[model samples]
Target chain A: MSVPVCVLGLGLIGGSLMRAARAAGRSVYGYNRSGGPVAAAQADGYDVSSDLGAVLSRAQAEGALLVVAVPMPAVNTVLQAIATTARDCPLTDVVSVKGPVADLVRDHGLDGRYVGGHPMAGTAESGWAAGFAELFRGATWVVSADEGRDPVVWAEVARLALDCGAAVVPAESQEHDDAAARISHLPHLFAETLALSGVRGGNLTLALAAGSFRDGTRVAGTSPALVDAMCEANAAALLRVLDEALETLAAARTALAAGSTSELTESGFAAHQKYLERGGRPSITGIVPGDHEWLARLRDAGRRGEALLTLPREVS
Target chain B: MSVPVCVLGLGLIGGSLMRAARAAGRSVYGYNRSGGPVAAAQADGYDVSSDLGAVLSRAQAEGALLVVAVPMPAVNTVLQAIATTARDCPLTDVVSVKGPVADLVRDHGLDGRYVGGHPMAGTAESGWAAGFAELFRGATWVVSADEGRDPVVWAEVARLALDCGAAVVPAESQEHDDAAARISHLPHLFAETLALSGVRGGNLTLALAAGSFRDGTRVAGTSPALVDAMCEANAAALLRVLDEALETLAAARTALAAGSTSELTESGFAAHQKYLERGGRPSITGIVPGDHEWLARLRDAGRRGEALLTLPREVS
Candidate 1:
């Protein structure tokens, strides 16, 4: 029989993981710091506990897999508790960023038992009430590995991701952070800025926004607390990507101001078309390259009004 | 009986207008410079003619309403032709910018018979084949009128908008341009710039761009020729709005750099929440005031973490 899985923190991600595990016919236990989430999970017909120590002890005794799905600020405290109380069980996490968590596991001498993970999926909603068993279906879940890490723990994490209906993508923690900054964090920042701009334009702008404005600013509607925490955690990486984006925007503005917008317009159209054609898959294989040569290729293709590259399908 | 309508130019907007008018049980005639759009409209069982003079003569003879639905570059030529051939018929045009078209109507001495119009609706796709009778359903069709303009013509335009299942919003030509700059043109510019930035981030950014990125940059996927024409026509107004948007973005960036992002975050969240609460309607009535007091109010609400204002429902 497969090992029992204990999920700590019964928020959206944690609750959804437990639900998926239960649906897959695996034994699952849930724990939350608050009595409300714990009671709610129990009401949902899942085994849950509010007492952290008792849950950790049960996990250790059952040789269970422990999944930490807390917000970033509470991650270290939970990790410390796990190190002391559930050291014998395999551990993994579902957090947005992996580098800091990976460092914490190494610092606590728990690297051998811990696998850093991030499921690249979410909606604007949160909390246990907003979660469902199929939240991670067809999602890409990144599993971070390093030298001296336990291969068995990594395998178990990948298996768990598959069980949750997610595709497993293995990478180093730093690689995941860089990619996350570019694709996820940077977009969130843009959405926030765009939202502010829309507000400044007053009501008419909002009324006229249509599909693009709504889509562009959708993430800005996320909780302010969550936006702050995520941005703060990855400030440096987000800044780097923001700076790059600013440069591109400035260049386009310059081209527009100079009455030579054709080049910029062509490039924008080409890249956007390519993005649609690929169905939103990453253009390169493995980790994203720092050089960004694909951008130049897109601009050239746009200028020529032809497709120059064929994007590969993402590995499921 | 309601006046028969004749639609010049059988592109997406023109074809859709013809289809909508026909669906409303109003007789319609379609005309195009090229044989292709004419033949396509005819195949759809629409009465179409390639001879512009014959169509305009018939429209004037029958006192039928004439709609000029063409791109910005071709608008003036069509206006000139209508001025000479169909001077007695009421005229309206579905162009993106209203100010220039209004000016042309005055210049052609057709102010009494002409109304400037812009329906705030479209998809990335274009052309006769992409036309649908319901394309304008629930959309806001802005009708621009000036003092001393024919009230009958304006009422007929509103009737036409209603027949297309769209709401009629009346405003001055310049007012329509200003509002369009903020809500429509500004968003399109931002989408293009964001698309360029995504291209620069390489394949990973594109792949990782889930809902927000796709939604934000959706307008960038529009046809390049159309993008160029629209931006060029509204360059001054668009640039003014862009400058305002850039200032807001700069402030947010500065806050982030100073490690004090709370203010920006709060404002973004407030605006976003308000956007959702209001169902994306403009908060104010009449012409959106030049001074944006609502933004400050949103920021204050966000800072206090309370709903301090109720957004007004949009007038249909």
Candidate 2:
């Protein structure tokens, strides 16, 4: 028989997991603090309830795996609850940031049965109503296991991610946080900073707000509270990455202000090289060498820095 | 009879203009330096050609309104060609930025016949191959005209933007540049900067790079040269906005570093208010004083920022 699954906090992530689990022929139980998401999940033909104890009891009885999908601050409280009442079941989480959540699990002494998981998939929409079975399709899901986590549990989590059509990438909690700081969190702050500036600039920007502005600000429109939580939870890492971005901006600013194309080109070349190296594994610093033609282009770009290199018209 | 429209360049913007004009039952002529686009467009049943002289003679014979949709560097050359060849025709341009292009037209003494128009719509894709009749649908197209521009020419240009499925917004050349700097050009720079950082931080950021990374970097993958040209052309305005963005980011950073939730919350609340005010007119500044409930929440947020404000669980 397929392993039973219990999903805690039946909002978007939890509700979707419940559906995907049931669709994969696994017995699933769900718990929520609020009645609405539980009701919506139930209405969608899943077994869910607002009764946390009942859900935990079901998971313990079935020896199922539990998926914690709650916000950051609430994560520790949920872990404590799981530790006290559902220690028999293995556990994984779906928080955006991993280090803090992983640390919480460690502090609660649930590391043995717990693995940290973050499915990098979401729409601008949220909640149970927004949950879809294929929401994780073709997306990357990061799974981080602390030292000595059960391999069986890790395999089960990887299986779930794959079953939901997501690519599973293994990582450590701090590694996950650092990576997300550069790629996800930093972009949010950058966009938020820009959007705020646009607002402060008044009518002119609003009038001219176009596709680029809308696209750039997409993540900024996420719940400010959530953003605050994320920044606060991952403060140190995010700030470090934010500093790097600021430094880059400063370099560009100095170059622009001084009419120094050479300085600007160094910055631009650094950026152009990285852009060409996308989808490869990212390092802490410097462009990764991949694709010979791409590297040659980077070399050429470096050689031609700031001289106003126009591409042949055929490119456009 | 409706105005005769001649679109120079015959690229995506120019081709789209021809298709949109034809769909609106207006006579359209297309001129391109490249034989390929001109031949392809002509074969596709457009009134297209490679002979600049023939295009000029035809427009002169029929008294056409000229819309130059060439790149920034090429705009002056196109304008000069039109001045010496199709001098009688009323001219407008669809370049992205205005001040430099406007200055060139002014210096060349083509201001009376030249109205600076930026039909604020484009896709990641380019060229005649990317042309679409609906490219400008529901878009805001700014017509940057000055006291030096003729009223008749300005009205006709407004009609053209409207006929292309865009709302016509009027502004001075400098105002257009400043606003585009804040909204369009600067955002591109920010996206590129962030995207490059992610790319450079490759191996370290691999597991962390997810949907947010992909979404934020979407514009970075756009033609770097086009973006660079945009930055170069609108350097002064972009530089100003970049400075403002730096200040905004510094305030946030200072708040974060200083451990001041009050300052962070204030900035965040202000950002929220601006988001709500986005897509409105260009005159309103300083959060409009209404919506007591929303204001109260923001004020409360300022006083006590919630670390985790999920959408009410019931909504999910």
Candidate 3:
């Protein structure tokens, strides 16, 4: 029989992972710190255990893969337990940030058996109730494993991502952190900043805000606790990107102050117009080109029906 | 019989006004500087003319109301011609910027019969082909008439807006400019800045830019000439709003650099969350409260049916 996959935390990411794995016909198990998620998972016909020792012992005996999908703050405690109990089980994580998680695994001397994974997919909603089997489908899942690490462990982690209907993108931890900081973290900060500015104008400004403003600040409506964790976890990388963004904004301000519309409107508008004409898809080196090929392999491996394996439509 | 409406310039705004007025069963005539838009407007069943004198003479004979729906740079030229030809014709403009148009009217000694108007609606698309009868439906159209201006003239201008299915918002020229700068122009500047930044990151950043980034920077895709004209026309007010935005962004940068996630994430998220919870509508003081009543009156006055007068759904 294929090795079972055990998910920890049972929150949005963990619960979704369990569902996705099961949908791929993999034997899946789940564990949650709270009884509520465990009971809910059980109700959903998922095999979940509240006892950590019982879950870990079964995982070790069956040589199952373990996925730690806990929040950034709770990752350390889970890591400590994993290092002591399931030392030989291949493991991965589904966290937003990778550097810190990689460091934790190294600290526990479990780096050889661990890989840092992050699925760039989620809605503003959270918790088990918000989880869905197709959350990771057609998403870009970043796998940050050390260059010299065991290829088998990396492959196993990639297999999990593929089973969830994702395209696996391999990168160093630092690279992943930097890119995430630029595209994801910094946008959240800007969204918050813009939203706060709109609020300062009282209700009239909000009333006048059209599609552009709404789209620009939609992420600002995300839960504060989650925002805090993500921003804080990737603080250094986020700060770097924010510095670049401030420079761009400052140049626009300078042009505005000087009544130089050419800078902000001429060159800026042309560049953006070009970007849009290209369908807004950025070309990533090495990875994006192989996306279709990798997806085909993944579909063949999972044996998911054609409907489940089709590429997702590009979000406009 | 109601006074016929003559539209100057057969671009998107002018063409749309002609179509919308016609849909309300108002007699309308359109004029264009070029053959292309005039032909296109004619093909769309609009009564359009290429000869300025013919259109102006017909309007004068009919005691028609004149709407200058030209670009910012072309507004003065149209005003000069109107002063020479249809000096006594009740005139208004559909320009994005009101202050300059108001000044032009005052310079031409036509303020007595002129009101500055702006419609807070548009898509990224432009030109005659982009014009539609429903373009102004449910949009906030600012009527910037001088205080103590002729009530009859103001009523005529309000009638046009109501006929087009828009809610009339009364404000001084400066107030409209300031609010437009804060809510509309400033967001475009920010969108352009962010889009330019994403371009600098190469194609990978664009590829990874998900829904939030796309929504945030959508306006950056607007035509450069249009963007340049809008920014240049309202440079003063836009500069002021840009200063405020820079300050807010700088605060976020400082917080990020200082590892103070609370400022950027906690308060920012809460404020945004509150804004969303309130349905993203900002409360405007004078015009918003009586929207329903004004709309009803407008429909009755225009003789448009209830189906045509239905309020537009608020864009979330």
Candidate 4:
């Protein structure tokens, strides 16, 4: 039988992962540090509990693949419990930023078995009740494929992502973090600033707002605490992109003052059209684990816009 | 019967105006500078032509209200035609910015019969085929109420807006320009810069983009020439808001560099929440055109988030 799945922290991503795993016919269970989601999951007839130690012990005895599904702040405690109770189980995480979580895993002496993952799917809502089995369906799930990482655990993570209905985009931790800093975190920052400036324009501005304003500022309405953690954790990469965006914006300001916004508008429109042209792309295949150049090939595929779950391999 | 409407330009905004005015049972006809949209409108059974002079002469004979629904660059030419042909017709415009259009009207010696109007609604699409009669349904239509302006023309423009299923918000041209800069132009600038930066983050970033990236960059994909003219026409107010946005973004960059984005995120989230709380507000009424303080009261009601279309008034 396939390895049993053990997910820690029953928040949106974790709870959804458990459900999707169960839907795929894998033996899946989860743990919640809080009592509410635990009781909710229990009532829903899922295997769950608030007892961290007991959950880790069960995972150890059953040889379950332990998934770190906690928020950034709670990651350390979860890692510590896993390090003490289930030290040898294969591990992965679903945190937004991979580099920081990888570093934390290293600190907790769990890096040998840990592969980082981030599924690019969410709504404005959060918490346990806001999740569904389809949250990751047809979405891109990035799997960390850093050099020198254990190949067996990498296959396990990729398999789980595919079974959860996500197309796997295998990337190195730093590459994933850097790209996310630009595409994900940077947009959150812009949304926040736009929302703030629009509101400060007073009641007339609010009354005049239409589609562009609403869509531009939509992500600013996300949970502040959640936004803060994801943005702050990838500060280095985010700062690089922020500086570039600021430079472009300042140039737009100069262009506006000089009686023409053509230069910025033209380039910006071209870039936006390029982004819009990325739909319905075909996924690449043939790369597989247990090959000498598998990691490099997988990462290259992801960079070239391919979301291929690697060819089936014998996981030792 | 309502006032006969003559629209100068059969592009999206102007064509939509002609359709909506006719749908509201007004006697509406239009002129197009180009032959393509004229033919398309004619195919749709619209009363449209490429003969600007003939259209204005017919408007003069019928004493129809004139709507200058051209882009900013074409405003002067259309106003010149009105000055030469239909100089006494009550005139208004659907251009994005108001102050510049008003100044152009004065330059063309057609200011006496002019009332600045802008329907705060449109899609990213342009040209005749992209418009429909329902484009402005339930949308805000800002009608300029500058002091010493002709009240008769203002009522004509406001009445047309109401008939097109839009709520009217009256303000001075400069006030409208200022608020438009903050709520509209600045967001466009932000979307442009953010889209440019994200695209530059390489292929992996583009592949990883989700809803936030798509929504934040949506308006950036609008027609670049249209965006440029609207933004460039309101340069003064746009520059001021752009500077303010830059200041906030610079502060966010500093916060991200300093290892905490809480300050920016918290305030931004609060601002976004405030914008969200503006739905279903009651429209303030009892402000009529013939009252002693009608102009000031209308402007006040607009600033207080009311979009009452005003009470009916007699026109001499």
User: Which candidate wins on lDDT?
Assistant: 4
By the DockQ metric, which is better: model 1 or model 4?
4
Residue runs of model 1 more than 4 Å from their true location after superposition: A1-3, A25-27, A57-64, A86-89, A107-109, A146-148, A279-316, B1-4, B43-45, B57-64, B87-89, B107-109, B199-209, B279-316
| Prediction-by-prediction clash tally | 1, 10, 5, 0
Better of 2 and 4 by TM-score: 4
Q: Name the runs in model 4 displaced over 4 angstroms.
A: A313-316, B43-47, B313-316
What i-RMS does each candidate reach, in Å? 6.2, 7.9, 6.7, 1.0
Model 3, C-alpha of B85: deviation from truth (Å): 2.4
lDDT of each: 0.73, 0.71, 0.74, 0.87
Off by over 4 Å in 3: A266-316, B273-316
Q: After superposition, how far is residue A171 of candidate 4 from its true place, in Å?
A: 0.7
TM-score: the better of candidates 1 and 3: 3
Fnat for model 3 comes to 0.52
Per-residue lDDT of candidate 1, residues A16-129 (tens digit): 999998888889997899898888888888899988899999999999999999998898888888888989899999988888888787788788789888887887788888
- For all the predictions, what are the DockQ values? 0.28, 0.19, 0.32, 0.79
lDDT of 4 by residue, A217-312 (tens): 899988889999899888888888888888888787777778999999999999998888876635766665757888888888777777875445
Q: Candidate 4 chain A vs. true chain A: TM-score?
A: 0.96
Which CAPRI level is candidate 2? Answer: incorrect
How much is the lDDT of residue B236 in candidate 2?
91
> Sort by DockQ, best first: what order?
4, 3, 1, 2
How high is the DockQ of candidate 1? 0.28
Instruction: Rank candidates, lDDT, best first.
Output: 4, 3, 1, 2
lDDT tens per residue, model 2, A105-222: 8898888888788887777677899888887776667767445556567667766776666665566677667777878777777778767766765564565677777777767777
> How does the DockQ of candidate 2 come out?
0.19
TM-score, per-candidate, Cα-based? 0.81, 0.74, 0.86, 0.95
